[model samples]
Target chain A: MQRLLYSLSGASGQHYSPHVWKIMMSLKHKGLDFELKPVSFGDISKIEDGSFTSVPVLNDQGTLLGDSFEIAEYLEETYQDAPSLFDGPGGLQLSHFVESYCKTVLHPTLAVIAVMDMYNIMSDADRAYFRPAREKRFGKSLEDVYAGRDAELSTLPEKLNPVRDLLTNQDWFGGEKAMHADYVLFGTLQWCKVCCPDPILAPSDPVNLWFERMLDLHDYMGRKAVSEAVAA
Target chain B: MQRLLYSLSGASGQHYSPHVWKIMMSLKHKGLDFELKPVSFGDISKIEDGSFTSVPVLNDQGTLLGDSFEIAEYLEETYQDAPSLFDGPGGLQLSHFVESYCKTVLHPTLAVIAVMDMYNIMSDADRAYFRPAREKRFGKSLEDVYAGRDAELSTLPEKLNPVRDLLTNQDWFGGEKAMHADYVLFGTLQWCKVCCPDPILAPSDPVNLWFERMLDLHDYMGRKAVSEAVAA
Candidate 1:
């Protein structure tokens, strides 16, 4: 019986999905070992009887899980003796607020900022499926979406102000230790780190510094991940 | 030991300061009874020898405290057996993230949206001080600052998406019960509820519903407050 994680991979095999990176770091945080199987855009629906539509689908020795938040909860409940991801109920619920921040504030901005770069790094089959879908969703051509990204890019720091403000007084989102809240935000930034050619944050920014520290966590799993931008 | 909370009040003696409201709710949440003392803008500098510059100053029998977060930590540490504001360190730290959200996203937008309303509710003396100070800060006259508020008002909903998204699945920021994070946001929205003439949230919005629940907490403390908007 083996644990397996189906992840979204870039053309060059960089595990680039933000949601997948969340569970990837969370699994490592819980001291769980799993084989990472890369899946392309077109391959997601075919992962398990066409039931799942996203990556970070965990096959934990026959128990299949889909959403990243659900997978995090499963890992926490299943590995009770391991280091707790959420310290208690307060941490657990507030972690959702962090997730909300990532979704509403970070994801949408990063999506526009890195759309073309994200498209450029996708497999041909993935690109074929991605372009029309995203173009329709964004209501613009991929190139057109990429054109106004400088304006979008300029807004990233302001979009990240909350995290920057939090980091001004604390080393991590989880206070003295890193927790799921930290991972939720790290996952968002990690997406841009792996995809965007233009730098998303300043080197001296507190959030950027926190990201640097996050990359070194879990024995450098994030640092060692097959980053497409790094490979370039 | 007498516990006294110096709160900022409007002309009609409404406790309108967002930071003060946080401590007000947190005090009640911990079941610690304190006398509420109203302070005008001019009186803040004269409070306890002019050292402290803000309201929500907690004078717990001569152990005067300033800063809402500091006061919260003091309560959490001083009263270990009471119902915890933060369930643990994780919750404590994440509450700061909530604070950051209130400061960057909610406060700025609400400040613009309710600038004139806030001025109108203040005493004539406060209006004089507030007008020049705000004009200097905004680089515009009070009327002009408020003239452009409709555009600012339109941005509030999207700005509040993070909180709205969080409340969809959970009863409160603390999951089963309210915590400091809930108070943190409650204080923010309650500021608008007391001062803003136009409704800041839709009647059916999840955030508005959560706020309604919040007002009813602590035996209708929020509902019982001398609301200037209610008086108007």
Candidate 2:
């Protein structure tokens, strides 16, 4: 029997990145036999110090794999018989674009949003809890970051103009097909909306419709409809 | 006839980011019937603010393949018998580590070296010519950067520790065969040596030996012998 396991966050499952939940929920809906193991990116001093002996690794019959992109690749390769999110060179191209969008553009933008959202939603005591972890990673004062929020937020709209342009009247970034890239982008966007609800992306674009459609995917709403409803 | 076009800048070539060249040389050696065309990364305006249309796209039979890793993957998939630097899952793992090292550590390190080599090696007027682009890409403040060079340099040791620990005094980064990862890392190392000679890595430990073996490779040395004889 084929099995899969994901390292997830236990305490901050409230602030869990949508990408993680997407993978977990996808497997669950498939009714596949799998296990979920919580892995902490929040305070991964062990990873930082190079004791990455066990972390977010996907195991295929006990063979461990690392790197989210690599794990995705391995899953695709190993489960060749499984329902595919990839189509061909075209699909690969689309997936590659989504990865780039997430890695280079959206991910960083979402990170900035995370800081803003934490401050906005969290209590003084609650903010204190997250601030230290963030400080370790960014080495910046949250007050200063918060002070410059409008300026930081302003630049994103222009940065997002290109993404918005791509989304203009399109059902998905990868065109008509709901490929892996769409799901990947959706995961990041979902996170961004929670972590940084910018009105710029809220206006009518075909992408918003696509976002709504993904919520209707099997187990997607079941797993997190309550959470997403709150965030939305 | 199958064709591929590489977008390039003759001067940005000086940064000697070997990931660009490794792909170039790989294609050159792969003996695939193809053509190379140079394009600009700065010409995002031409792309009209689209998604992830970054450097080094391979145009094969009118299909656009961007992202060097994906390009390599596409070629490997499309051409079964092309001379492959990567072979299997271990090959994938090694290539990933090399990519991670390059982006996270080596390329940034080498960029510093490239500037210095250009500074030390370039004539006063030639320095004037290349300064703006370097300044634009890296930053205008060389003295500030050079001040923290030792600190930044320390990260290289820490970063390479994984490869070093896993290698355990081996012939290659991925066991016996010189795989894609070795080539990728070697390309960066080679670029750094040419662009900036460093005591840390120049007369260093495993780096020195690894350098020798990489240069000893027929394809690698062939390029070296050409570059050495040519006046850059």
Candidate 3:
């Protein structure tokens, strides 16, 4: 039996990784045996520097696995008894939508807007310094950060409808059982929730309802290796 | 005999994705049959709002796959006869590095900085006004981007030294023989070359040499994909 370690970090509100939470639930739900360790963000001093290794890393014995997508894919596939992230055509299709949501929709629009300085967390001096400085570079204003997001939200219906349709058609995004698509959506939506105000993009009641059901499994995480505090 | 359809954007210089290139090469090296299609960047709008879905997406019949990481991982497992990206422990280690390189080093540093304006062919205003504007957001001026990157470049030896040191121990990044690690490095570094003038953090002669070797792999990219028209 390979002992697994999940290294992750979330402190204050700076951490936007819902991946840790989802994985915790998945592993527990599957009853897969593994260790979990929450790593602090930016502990490069712990890095070998030769490997330039960073965390949200998974270590099995000495071998390392990281990258949320890769990690999720590997875990689901390697564990025969576990739920899968990608099952068939519908699963594959929803994955395409979620990928865009993370990078195109979430990273730029949500992540840029909801940082500490971007919010009221930072002191005025700090805001004037790093916030204004980075803002000019990405080519937007403090206002423009969320300005056209309303417009961008309008476009999600066509892009996300496929997945939205999946919600009602199947118990999960993959159209059979809840699998990796649920986790990916859960993670991205979590990140979006932290980084940007929830956009009333589409009538996402089913998506919201699915989240309520997901919590039933989160208790399974408490019975697993990553039961520390949970993402509050 | 699953017919893999690879749709690539017509342009080559900046939008070049190393992940796509890696999968393409893996399929070729294995003599696995796949159909190659050159997709225009955004000439025809996709069902999704994103252009990436319109680019280098793979279809097994009508089944869709998106995102370089996902697509490459999909290909790696779906076709066992195709060159494997993840073989075992050592291969997984390299895959993590490739994933990290994409997120930590490549996306924020290289893609955001060098390839920003290249994403959309610059109008005069984009060239003059937006070019410099985007560069500064990286917390470095163009000159600073160069200088700041030297520190990051030195770190690569650490992240990669495990493999480079392995060359003395065995063959490619994975060890005994060339595995997906070689292709991952190739794709990422190729993305660096096309997107950024600098390779391996600076004018790296070693990287240049390796690049030449990778290009020689006949099916590395369909020769016609990067013809005079797309090469522009």
Candidate 4:
């Protein structure tokens, strides 16, 4: 069966959507060969017969799947004999906890820190749609919303204290192996890495070290991905 | 073989130490029969031997274990035939993540919100030790530390947003069944319930609902425990 993953991309072909990256890593972990189809914001709704409105809409043997978590669940159940994304019973809940942590704690912080950098890297059409939507959400212009970027960026390390402490004791969030939980966090960090030049984690920090190790996984797929910030 | 768990308690015999509660819940989950020995802050160092200086020193068949996480590991490994505290592979890491969350996020916030209540509930000896130690940690008097508690308490719901979101779709942090991850968070909330008059969670919140369900677990052990704040 042919598997194709539709991922959100930048003008320079940088795959930066955290949700899309999550499914990419999950598919790789399950040893599934998949092709990536880059999509712009304007192209999302038109994919898979206008049924979906998001990046990471996976087409597996002509069956369309949306939402990273739902796609992960589908992959886990369908490819049951393949290496498990969730190591065991409690893993599904923990992976969801990691997802929530990324959404509630990390995403907003990253959005503020990388607002201008993200704008600089997007296609003109995406930029047109991004500004008004984000301004409406923040109730402020992009420039005004990102004015407190330094203070927001300083809070990132403190917010990541739990993850740092976890990495201090274990090699991965999934204990010995990197599972969906690890990928969930990796995707968030990867989003920042792909779009922003300022480093989210220090080189000496355990989380940064873990990120480097994660980049080496699956034949250095993350390391080889184009960083729009670096490219520009 | 007899099993004994030394737990930190207040003057009115409320088991309020979050660390101790974690072991209590773990022991129950593993189906191990144990006795709870209530101790004050001053009594911690003198529990099993002078080697340890903390509560939750588990004495099992002559083997002494300190640290809640270590005690849990010992229980899980030693009682391999019994039920597991960590349901599977990733569970250990996720359980640790929950522990780190309680330590980094919840503990400090709870300490400030319940400072006065905790001080009031402590034994005279523990009060002398707790006040100076805590005051030094905050670099202020207990009164000053607690003065900003209303603001600090307000941030707790936001801090607990991840857990609340996790519980929205699952019954527990441990997925279908309550495991160590559930116990890890339960211990933190249980500490506040035991020591403070003000409820940390609103009655209608998912976290509050989950707490009520947690209290009913292990044959109502948490619900049956005395609340020092309520007693006074």
Best by TM-score: 1
- What's the TM-score, to 2 decimals, of chain B in model 3? 0.62
lDDT of 4 at A180: 90
State fnat for each of the candidate structures: 0.74, 0.00, 0.00, 0.65
- Candidate 3 ranges beyond 4 A from true positions: A1-10, A13-15, A18-22, A33-41, A44-55, A83-102, A112-137, A141-158, A194-204, A220-232, B1-232
Categorize the docking of model 1: medium
Q: lDDT tens string, model 3, A1-232? A: 4655544333432333566555654565466667655444334225322242544555545656666656666666677565445553223322433443445434454444444323443334434554666577668776676566566555544434434444544565433456665666666555444434344334456655665565456454322222222333
Q: Evaluate model 2: give its TM-score.
A: 0.44
Task: Judging by TM-score, tell me the better candidate of 2 and 4.
Answer: 4
lDDT of 4 by residue, B154-220 (tens): 9999999888878888888877788888888888889889888778889999999999999999998
Model 2 CAPRI rating: incorrect
Lowest lDDT block of 10, candidate 1 chain B: B223-232
DockQ of each: 0.78, 0.03, 0.02, 0.70
Residue pairs in collision within model 4: none
Q: Relative to the unseen true structure, what is the C-alpha lDDT of residue B61 in candidate 1, on a scale of 0 to 100? A: 88
TM-score of 4: 0.94
lDDT of each: 0.89, 0.54, 0.50, 0.86
Please give, for residues B1-232, the per-residue lDDT of candidate 1 as tens digits. Answer: 7999998878878778999999999999999899988888899988875788888899998898999999999999999999999998888989999999899888888888878988988999899889999999999998998998999989989999998898998979999899999999999988877887677899999999999999899999987773534774
Instruction: Give the higher-lDDT candidate: 3 or 4.
Output: 4
Full candidate order by lDDT, most accurate first: 1, 4, 2, 3
Tens-digit per-residue lDDT, B211-231, candidate 2: 677776755652464365235
Please identify model 4 stretches exceeding 4 Å from their true place: A227-229, B227-229
The Cα error of candidate 3 at residue B170, in Å, is: 28
lDDT of 3 at A164: 48
Sorting all predicted structures by TM-score, with the top scorer first, yields 1, 4, 2, 3
Error of 3 at A5 (Å): 5.6
